[model samples]
Target: MAAWQAALKWAGEHWSPAPHLHFVPAQQEDLPMVEALAREIWPQVYRELISADQIQYMLGLMYNVPHLEEEVRTRGVRYQLIREEDGSMVGFLGWELEAGSGANHSTALLHKLYVKPNQHSRGVGASALAHVIAEATIAGASTLQLRVNRQNRKAIRAYLRAGFEFEEDRCTDIGGGFVMDDHVMVKRL
Candidate 1:
């Protein structure tokens, strides 16, 4: 591994083992693990912010194995599994390049970023975001964007602390009597 990667690995190993971020490439075989994480984390994160029915609907729409497979294989979404030194998965992120582009600034969408509830307030999300920023920069994307529920103050603050600015409000109907009311946030890399 490169020096930085080695250092990152060492940090994950020697620091608080459960919270430091070490990103492992998620493969098709890891789909079930990701689904399991969604099951565990989503309710904790969104329970008060959204209805239970909406939570279940969104989870099924997003984290099912076949959909995840299609995203990784055909839609070019990159899934990075967050792992501890002990090889336990703790979190995951998914991202993909957005459609529009310009010579000066390309955009990438941060489709998802979820850390275990117990792991919050640690540097896991920040570390994963730093890694994503570097990857986006390398891929020629100068801006990274994501959508968060408007009422999810914790997450909005986290994104703000990471230098993401509020871009706009977005409301999208996801069907099944659910609508996502969100704030679009963007960080210019």
Candidate 2:
């Protein structure tokens, strides 16, 4: 069986009803909330993987309200705020459909997938991933891809558990003297 299928099966056998989660599409008015969540989650998430300065720089570059709004308005990216059954926010996901070139198939680029540090190991990430995969499939994407920090072993393992195979290594310089050294992983739909 495929890794994702096996992972889903494992989740089914383990978590009785799974986590009651909701994915709310982010709007212009909702950008500030999304930014707030990022500010809260990033320091904890990247404390070990990156320096404080780099983290602050990245947050300012990627999670700033104006930048996020531009991403939604101009780039066709989709951002969703993940919430619980009680209507409390937990995490968020960001993705965009990339058009195919020549013989390549269209792909879904998972730009972000983050959960509160306290929510780890409770099946929130798995459920969120399953939702993204189903949504991407419904949108006609043949594959899903993402770039994860090379040093983020926890996230790397999670992606592997979800059937994403390592595709390549990329070292990108995002200005401000900071670099993103990541592993590009892909899962065929």
Candidate 3:
């Protein structure tokens, strides 16, 4: 199979989080919080590696209100929010299941998944991941896939801990003069 084809196939596996994280589907009313998350995670996560232009474009394409609304409406974009015991939105995971022709493949793409910087290493990210994967598994999805910047070791470690194996053959490059250099990862149920 070609590299891209191989990647898609790898993306079609089941994944589950370790434990303790909750997954709640996001609603239109959650748009504000979602937008806020993009804003928050951006400076903390992307500002260092990506240029301002890249940041603007990525955030515009991924987290803008209209984009999220569309994801909620037509796209199978499921938003799973993570919170603290006190009820603050600590992190979130956005994904699309069975997005294309391979319905049985039950593929999912994780568009947004992040935990607050200060909250790192505290299991917030892991819990959110588990919540998202559990939801996908419950929906009968065969695979769960996401693109993590090759340079992001922390996020990559979390995915690996959740049982996702690096899909080196299926990296996707979404052009705009900005390269994702993404590593496709998958886990089987």
Candidate 4:
């Protein structure tokens, strides 16, 4: 059974802005569509850092279509799509809800946010981020947290403009000696 089915409270479905962009909760069928986008977004970076297996592993954890389906199905997390009226997904955002333990009330984690590189600098990212903050606020989140690669200064600036402040530095313990530099940031809602 789907998480929404298992739950007693039903969250609302779907939102639209200006007809050009629609914000909707993810469904199982949308995963492949999102994954295709991720494929375009993922390799632009990871292929330089490690083996193809690790690249695949990273994508699986971050963008596996079925994993996204299961996340929505189990309510561990949920994905949203920002689609054009013509039915193409222009951007995507997904997050972890209620993910932290103890005293972390109303907390959310942004897992992924991507818009095509061609869509850069034209408010595609801003639009998607605005939608994300709105959604998170609706979910009663007091704060939103996300990690970005320290190398991604441009994105860091975007996060800052979106009201996030640098929280700390982090390291992803991939295993053994491998670690990825991550800058943790959070925005209070």
Candidate 5:
């Protein structure tokens, strides 16, 4: 079976009434849809955590079509749109596998995982994360790591619930006079 198919089966056994989610690999033609979802999700999610200027700047840097295309086509990053069985998009996530220094060890960097505001509290996020974890494991990653803004308490809680522990604090100056004050979280596979 495909890795994700096994992951879905595992999720069904783990999460009650598991989320009927399908992870569709995003292509060049799908950039516009991903951008639209980002435009819709980021503001509502970061409104209280960061400034409007920062939000717009980060959006332009990360979600613009050209940048996304480059990340997918040239950078080895993988983007997947999360959808329900009924063919509605509910969320999206981006991830990439980073080779560790030695053989038999690697890390999966989860760059983005955002669900629609209205879908909060449902199993969509959890299921998506479970799927990623499974895929990473199948890909031989020994760890899964992500960065979450320090002030985003809700996301922090969710990560904690998913077995991720705070590893360290990071402040990255992503140009444009804006810095990301975040906590690096890691989960062992």
Candidate 6:
């Protein structure tokens, strides 16, 4: 079978019908819902890795409706919703293609992947990642890159299982006296 066919089959098996998971691009109208989910999920997910104050700060910086809308409309980052067959949103992903770096394939940044804490370990993350891979591949990106907090072992393990390798360590000053200390992970498409 062709590579694309194999990918399609894999996605179908893991996400279509049986698993009842679907990835859909977010629209402007979906901003409020996405913001609500992010607010619900981020605190629990980041609690162990960051302080409460930082969590609130980051949430405001990233998940506010205005910021999300700007990201979707102006920044060209794609926001995808993870939904169940029953039409419930469980998670979301963000990515954007980086073009013209003179590489063999374009690089896409996998900005965010958040699954509701209660829904972890149910293959939700893996399926969501696979969907992103297929989407990035279709968009002509040869690599997908993301950063995880250095102390986020669970997420690191997930990325490893999803075929990503640690690329480097990074520290970014995101203003407000906070810094994101992270390990950059990359998956080659």
TM-score of each: 0.87, 0.89, 0.81, 0.77, 0.89, 0.88
Superior by TM-score: candidate 1 or candidate 5: 5
User: After TM-score superposition, what is the CA distance of residue 3 in candidate 5 from its true location, in Å?
Assistant: 34
Per-model C-alpha RMSD? 7.6, 3.3, 6.2, 10.7, 6.5, 5.7
Question: Residue 132 in candidate 1 has what lDDT?
Answer: 86
Model 2, runs deviating above 4 Å: 1-19, 100-104
Candidate 4: residue pairs that collide: none
Clash totals in order: 0, 0, 4, 0, 0, 0
Candidate 6 lDDT by residue in tens digits, 33-152: 888899999989999899999999999998998999888777688998899989999999999987454456689999999999999978898888888888888988889999999999
The better candidate by lDDT, 4 or 6, is: 6
Off by over 4 Å in 4: 1-19, 45-54, 100-104, 175-178
User: How well is each residue in 1-189 modelled by candidate 2, as lDDT tens digits?
Assistant: 477668754654464324588899998898898899999999999999999999999999999999999888876788999999999999999988884422346789999899999999888888888788888888878899999999999998778777788999999999999999999999887
Q: Which model is ahead, 2 or 4, in terms of TM-score?
A: 2
TM-score of 2: 0.89
Q: Please, what is the whole-model Cα lDDT of each candidate in the order they appear?
A: 0.85, 0.87, 0.73, 0.72, 0.87, 0.85
Where does candidate 1 clash, by residue pair?
none
lDDT of 6 at 114: 95
lDDT of 6 at 149: 98
lDDT value, residue 28 of candidate 1: 86
- Compute the lDDT of residue 119 as modeled in candidate 1: 82
- Any runs in candidate 6 off by more than 4 Å, and if so which? 1-18, 99-103
Better of 4 and 5 by lDDT: 5
Task: Report the CA-based lDDT of candidate 5 relative to the real structure.
Answer: 0.87
lDDT, model 3, position 120: 84
Sorted by TM-score (best first), the order is 2, 5, 6, 1, 3, 4
Q: Could you tell which candidate, 1 or 2, scores higher by lDDT?
A: 2
